[model samples]
Target chain A: MNKIEVKGLYKAYSDKGRRINGYDECRLPEGSTVLHDINLSIKRRSFTCFVGPSGCGKSTLLRIMAGFEHPTKGWVFIDGMPVNGPSPRHIFVFQEDGLLPWMTTRENVALGVRDIKDSDERRRRIIEYIELVGLKGFEDHYPHELSGGMRRRAEVARALITNPDILFMDEPFGALDFLTRLQMREEMINVHMMFDTTILFITHDIDEAIQLGDQIVILSERPTNLRADIPLAFPHPRDFTKGGLAALRRDIYFQMGIHTAL
Target chain B: MGEDGGERKNGFMKGALSKCRQADRILPALTVVVIIALWEWVVRIFSISPGVLPPPSRVAAALWGLAKSGVLFDYTVASLFRVTWGYFLAVAAAVPIGMFLGLWPLGRAVFNPIIQFLRPISPLAWIPLAILWLGIGDKPAVFLIFLAVFFPMLVCVMGSVAGIKVTYFRIAQNFGLTGYRLYTKVVLPAALPEIVVGLRITLGTAWLVIVAAEMIAVKSGLGYLIVDARNSLRMDRVIGGMVVIGIIGLALDRIIRRLETLPSVRWKRMQR
Candidate 1:
């Protein structure tokens, strides 16, 4: 059964004329459509990766599904109930610098299970989640003190500790260096395998999508529409150097207007 | 031989760095000494009247006299007392009001223009009205200092809260944090560093206003000491009062600056 469903999702930012403050200057112009007719459904516990061109609004789609943003025209259903606003049942792992800088890793991860009535249980789970993300010794370190990958891991742990039914990640590893990104991808797969949650990840990297996603969804540029949805039936440790994975990679490159042969 | 060269280079760099650190400590003291020496030299060389400009030695003697009499202690305490009452009261009121205005756009839209209008008007300009409304002594002086601190602090806290990254709020919302939890968990911590900076700047303004306010509204602070000395043709005592004000201002600034180094707000330094 589909754990999450987005039907005829559309988003547009209406410019409210001249804004007095500098904060509103970056917003899209009046009636600028970002996401148009985005329809998607994800099976329970599936790992889905959304890949698109820059500014194609894949993040918008994810945010809408996560209920951080509202769709201008259609409905998003999570387990057949409409999403009115962000809920603890679904958590978002921001692309960069989401963990509050003022908080240490332990304090930040503790925010996830703050509602738990038992103090001992909460403390144990905080420790458990921190260790799960491989941030054991760095629990007392602030976000600014941690390396980029470690901060990302801490954020992931914070999200996972809540035991949400769905996790939305918006390019969570995009800021990490090449080596850290590879290590995080491996850890992410382990996390997916161990957790029962449905994961919807947004990334611009096609190769990353091919490696991490159980199903890959491609999106087109502004006024974004679903271009393709391809299911990967193959097993883990996907090598894009040869076989069906490589063929798919080539196909995605072609779809995105890139010539891998060149 | 190569290792010896590397060790010698490291030693040389370390020595240079220590010398730089020493200079940081010594330079300001050196400048103060040089300026005082120049002032004394000019006064002595020109044979100027002491009333026109007293030498540092005479100023020091006047300070010694005030200390011996205990009036200096009393005046300093009076000024600090007023500043404490006014500044803390402003902080208590402005922070919450600023947070509310920052969180709600409608409140900000209505109040911001009025605040901006009042902020530009000098606190000294309120002396007449403050005297009329609150009457003499600490009340009027404290009121002026409060006026001096409040508007700037409100604007500062508003900016700080408003400047909090939208991502933090989204994270808080995603975790089901709302209302009071949102403020305590996300808003307060995120805005704290900037708020501390605002507090420091506004404390300086409060100190500045207290002196001027005391000159008119009260008669027991450093401002009054300076005015009384001038009336009695005691230029040395006036200079003594000015020096005391400068020292206390520096002390107050140093005290507030310590808040910036706290573990929670220390991320502000790293951001730079």
Candidate 2:
């Protein structure tokens, strides 16, 4: 089943009446479009990665899907209902650090599950998620006090504690060190298996897309449109150093028109 | 004999260490003493009239006289009371209004011009109007202090709220926080460091205004003591009042600086 559907999505940045051309009408300013004619359907409980070059509006599309932004023209339907605004049923993990500096790890996570009325239940869930992210002892630490990877884990814990139907992660591990990034990818896969939630992950890294995505949607340069779609059906614990993975990486690079040096 | 010898050695070492510690304080004390002695010498050598410029000794004598008569106590209490009430009232009013203006563009557009216009006009400038409107006494003095404090506080709080990273708001929104919950849980805490700074600054402003306000609009305060002593040709008492004001201002700033060390509101720069 399709969890989300987008049709004819167009977004442009413009001010009203700035480009008025006629007595009867005003046209949208030219050269302002970010995403044009975007159509996508994301399947339920599947991980989909949107891969694109920098400034290709992949993040904007994710934001539109998560209701952080509105498309200039089109409809985004979640469960056949048009998304009006950000909902608690969907969570967005930003690329940059978004953890509130003033809040402790426990408070940040608890902020996610604010709808939980019972105090005891909220505390239990907060602790469970904090431990799930391996931040058990650091619950009382603020974001500034934590390491980069720990802060990211705390943010992921904050998102997962709410148990959203779909999680939109826009290069959430992009700021971590190489080793931490690899560890986080594995952590994410473990989390996906445990939660079975729909994930729309955006990234510029082709390897990350292949590693985490069940289906990868490639995006073109701005004004961005869907370029190609690839499906990966490799089983869990698949190694990138293996045979099939190397070919897949080459294919993705070919599609992106990048020739890597041997 | 061994234990006694060790105890004596320990005591001697402790005394030496304490004396070394006290040496740190003695430098500033020595500077103050030298300055006072120089001031006394200059006055004597110049044959300066007592009415024109009182020496340090006469200022001390006058301060002692005021303390003995309970005049200094009365004036200090009066000034402290006015500052406390006026400054707190300004904070109580400014914070919420500032938050509202900071968050809402329309509200800011409506009131920002008026605030900017009033901000530059010193609170001392408002004394005559305050007296005209509120009548003579603590009311006018308090009113002037409040006016002095309100604008800077409002600007600081508003700017603080405006300066919060957009990421924080997005995080709060993503978690389904709305309205008052959004403010109490996210906005207020995030803006607290700046708000504290604003409060500290406005406390200084309030203190400054109280002296000026009391000089014109009230019967009793440090400012009144200065003005009254000057009129009576008692330069020593006037100098004593000025010294009291300086000491009080220094203490107030130090107290606020100490508040910056609190864990919950500790600024990044101020944190050890």
Tell me, by lDDT, which candidate is best.
1
The top-ranked prediction according to TM-score is 1
Q: What is the C-alpha lDDT profile of model 1 across A1-262, one tens digit per residue?
A: 6898888889887757323343312356678899889888999999999998988398778888888778899999999999989998899998887898889999999889979999999999999999998989999998887889999999999999999899999999998999999999999899899999999999988889999999999999888999999998878988988999888888988998897553
Badly placed stretches (over 4 Å) of model 1 are A17-27, A259-262, B1-19
lDDT of 2 by residue, B1-272 (tens): 27699799999999999999899789878998899899999999999998899999999999999999999999999999999999988889999999988887678889999999999998888877888999998888888888888899999888888767666777877887889998998788878888888888888888888998888988899999999998898999999999999999989998998867765577344323
Q: List the residue pairs that clash in candidate 2.
A: none
In the order shown, the chain A TM-scores of the predictions are 0.95, 0.91
Clashes in predicted model 1:
0
Recovered fraction of real interface contacts per model: 0.69, 0.40
Model 1 superposed RMSD (Cα): 3.4
Backbone clashes in candidate 2 total 0
Task: Give chain B TM-scores in order.
Answer: 0.92, 0.87
Candidate 1 lands at a TM-score of 0.94
